[model samples]
Target: MLQRGVRAMRVLRASSVGLTRPAASRSLAPNAARFSSSRSRFPAPLVASPLLQRAGLFAAAAASTSAACAFCSSSNVAMSPVAEAAVAEKAAGQQPTVVLYQYEPCPYCCKVKAVLDYLNIPYEVVEVNPLTKKETQAFTSYRKVPVCRIDDEVVVDSSAIISRLRELVVAPTTASNEDEAALAEEEQWRQWVDQKLIILTPPNIYRSVPEALQAFDYCLTEGKFTPMERRLSKYAGAVVMYLIAKRSKKKYGIEDERQSLYSALDSWVAAVGDDRAFLGGAEPNMADLSVFGVLRAMHGLDTYEDMMRETAIEPWFSRMTAKVGSSSRTASN
Candidate 1:
């Protein structure tokens, strides 16, 4: 079991270089809600299988490694929610103990952090050990990282967490058609962030051995592995991710990862347009934040630098960084 686990981690950790199957292309729904309730749950949880199962393990490790490799430093951002979420728990004389179980550099994990930071919700971070996953063992079935434990209830999936937190902090309001239309747009772009933009990251990051090693180095620096584990994972994970990246391009029909990324950014910029400061006009909406969060996760890598150089996303990104303020992390382990 131990040997199998180690082998799986080596093979799977590099899968984080954005190896998840691409979301099928779909047109926007006219009546898309402010946030879709259809959560991004992994197909199966870890404990359900006798074996540490390839698919679930791939998701867990991929999420962990992808998150840890990119934008490890941007965790601390200034809080800038125009309509601040109330500290409701404080009114009851008890604050919610929010603990984020994550893989430091994963874009999904980064998405969650972006929301938390934007809302100025202070929370603790628990870096899940990618191999043993003992940090999340209590969940039994749901073993993926970026799991959020708010007070007693546990929330898995990045979108679900973001939606739940918004619900808890900001009261729902009746909307005008204009408001609804705005929300529909936000929802569409948010979905695109998960399905389209994120799929391009791994292949681009692990385009070659050197790039793969650089990614693993970031992972090693940010993850909670021991000395021996670090040495093994860094070398083995990089090589595996490099191989996986090649297969990912073929599987996704991405002829060129960087070009695809640039095209995606261009599409986003076009949507924002010359008239509006953001997709939401004067303010950054959920969609804007979601896109920013995913892109921010790729920070510090060559892919990130290249994207910034090659795309028109920098201005909007700069605005987001200013609006999304400082780190809301109250603690970590």
Candidate 2:
């Protein structure tokens, strides 16, 4: 009975904040020209400095007249049939609704936010309580969050939500051989982020008792925990998570979790190469956004600061931060 209780505690700690940092303006160097990939249907943003580039991309995206703040519905651009239908519906006054069910700390939820911000999609956020999880009770099929409702259709899982959102905005188009290869590469790395990178997060976040406590403290500060729950989670939760993180290291055969994270990021940098400002050449693709979102969850923690200091990922990360900075379209409930 004791063993079962301990296991449940570990699981609960594994599942579960927000850190508010003031935004800043930033710049980026030039990148390679656009490739002819067909997988992801992202807007073709301008390739230039931060302000000028984003300005150009926003121009391309065109401002929407709809009350919904439809950022991507440009009349000049040819969208996929599905996207066109959504636009047409919006025109008919049936504005599309997007709602995200998530908790702030989850990397998976962050991934969805990154995609939405980059795509300039307006969405509402419903922050689910980590303890009761009563908010997500309606989603009995799959309770774990990052569940999203696009209009009337509910999509579960981060990757699936991203894919569905892509279908709603951009239409498929032909790409050159080189572009196809690049898109394929983007898809490959996006999968890597989920498979290889995400698993390393908890181990580093809870590598030691202090780190674990720090993580919980940040969570409690940003979360909606009651006073009693806060005390229990801040103290007891930290110790449990610390032990679970150690066991996680053994399970994954990771001798040094930080080193593994650094090496993995190094591999990503190499794949990105120095010529391109992003994996998607001039603009960020799905893979770039995925990595940024996952890593962003570690903000305000030691592991994140160490990563910025120790790795070459900072430049690219900074550029992405500038590009995908907070979206005005987002509202939190």
* lDDT winner: 1
Tens digits of per-residue lDDT, candidate 1, 193-308, equal 76688768778888999888887775466556677766665675576556656755786799988899999999999999999988977767778877888888778889989999
lDDT digits (tens) for residues 52-133 of candidate 2:
2222111211221111011111111222344445544544323247788876656777877777666556687776554444
Error of 2 at 290 (Å): 0.7
Q: Rate the local accuracy (lDDT) of all candidates.
A: 0.63, 0.61
lDDT of 2 at 150: 75
Q: In candidate 1, which residue ranges exceed 4 Å CA deviation?
A: 1-95
Candidate 1 local Cα displacement, residue 305, angstroms:
0.7
